[model samples]
Target: EEKIPGVYGIDTRALTKLLREKGSLLGKITFEGGEDIEFHDPNQENLIAKVSTKEIVEYGSGDKTVVLVDCGTKYNIIRCLLRLGVKVVFVPWDYDFTQMEYDGLFISNGPGSPEFAEITVEHIRKAMEIGKPICGICMGNQLLCKAAGAKVYKLKYGHRSHNQPVRLVGTEKCYITSQNHGFAVDNSTIPSEWEPHFINMNDGTNEGIRHKTKPFFSAQFHPEASSGPKDTEFIFEEFVNLL
Candidate 1:
C-alpha cells in the first residue's frame, strides 16, 4: 500500500444516500497520524457579524430607497433590487437604520441561526414599529418571523438547493425556488397578525410569511436566484410595488 499520510476518500453515493435518509449532519475528517479534529457547529455564535459589511455601502440612485441589512447578504439580491431602479443602502447587521428615511427595509440572507442575530432581530422590531414596507430572504425570513413573535428551529436536513418547490398558501400555484438555509420558522408559533404565505411542497415547511395589516413579508428562498430558475422573480416586483 502507498504510504500516504494525509489521504482522504469520500464516497459520494453513500453520503448522498445518508443525507437523503437522515438529512444534513455534522462530521469531521481526520488523518491517521494527524491531530484529531472536532466538528464545530457554525450556528452556535454570532455569524452575522463575520459576514456583514463593516461600513455603509450604497448602490444605484433611484427614487425608492431601501435600507438593506447586510447579514452575509448575497450579491444577486442587491443586483436584483438595483435592476428595479431602487437605491440600495447596505448596512451592517447590527447597525440601527430605523431612524433613516427609506421606503423599505430589506433583510438579506446570511449564515448561522437567527437567534444568534439578536441585534438584527431588534432592528427588525424597530422597523415594524415604523410600519414601512419590509422584506427578507433566507435567514431574513426567520429573523422576520422571530421579530413578529414567532419561533424558529433547526430543520432536520434544512432546505439547501435550487429547484425547491414552494406553493402559495391557500392556492394551487407552485413555483420552483432557490434556497439555502439550515433553519426554518415554526409555523405553529406565528402570531395572529402574521400568516403563512408560502410552504414547501416537498416537506410542508413554512417557506414565506406575511403580516395581515403591515407591509412586512419574507421568503425562505432566493427570488433573485443567481444561477437557478427565475420562476419566482416576480416576487421582487411585488415587493417593489409594496414600496
Candidate 2:
C-alpha cells in the first residue's frame, strides 16, 4: 500500500458506476476529528507546471533533432523517438524553443485545462509560422488546436481507457487507440485550413486534427501506448518521417 493514507468503507464499484453515469465529479474525503480540507479540483490547477521539467534535458544522439515541449510528458514518448534515432531536446511547458534549431516541434501530452498553457499555445503558433514539422498527443492535441485558433472543451466523463476506436477523417480505416483525456478539441471551430483528421467512433468527438497543407498535426490518443494498446504506434513513425 506504500503506507499511503486512504479512506475506507466506500463501495468502489458503485462509485465507479456513478462516475461513469454522471461524468466526473469533485469530492473531498474527511474523517471524524480530522482537520477539514478544501475541495481540490485538479482540472483547475496548472498540472503541467507541476509535472514538466524545470530545465532543458537532452536525450539520444541521432541526426534529426526534435524539440519536445514537456507539458507533463510521458517517458515512452522519448523512448519511441530514441528508438527512431532522433535527438530529443526536452523543455518545460512555457520555455521558448522557436529560437533554437530543430527539425520538428513536439507538444507532449499533459493534464488540466489548455488555458493554463497559453504561453505554449503562443509558442506553437510561432513555430507554425516557420513551417517546422509539428506533432502532439493527448493534451498536446488540445494545445495544438488552440494554437490553430480552435476551441477546446471539457469532456463529460472523458475517454480514460485503453481501447478507444478512432476512424480516419474520410476513410473507413479505424484504429483502436489508448486515451486518457478530460478535454477535446472542437472540430467545428477548427480553421478552414485545418481539418479534423480523426474521429472518435464512440462519442464522435474530435480525436485528431491536421493542417490542410502544412506538416502540423496532433492526436488526442496516446500512440506510445505505455500501459495500453499499440495499435497507433505508426503515428510516431509518420511524424518522424516528416522531419
Return the top candidate by TM-score. 2
Please give, for residues 1-243, the per-residue lDDT of candidate 2 as tens digits.
Answer: 698768988999999999889999889878789899988889778999999999999999999999999998999999999999999999999999999999999999988888899999999999999998999899889999999999999889789898899998989899999999889888789999999989999999999899999999989999999989988889899999999
Model 2 per-residue lDDT at 42: 90
Stretches of model 2 off by over 4 angstroms after superposition: 1-21
The positional error of residue 49 in candidate 1, measured at the CA in angstroms, is: 0.8
**Candidate 2: minimum summed lDDT over ten consecutive residues — where?**
1-10
TM-score of 2: 0.93
Q: List candidate 1 stretches off by more than 4 Å.
A: 1-22
Give the per-residue Cα lDDT of candidate 2 at 194.
96
The C-alpha TM-scores of every prediction are 0.92, 0.93
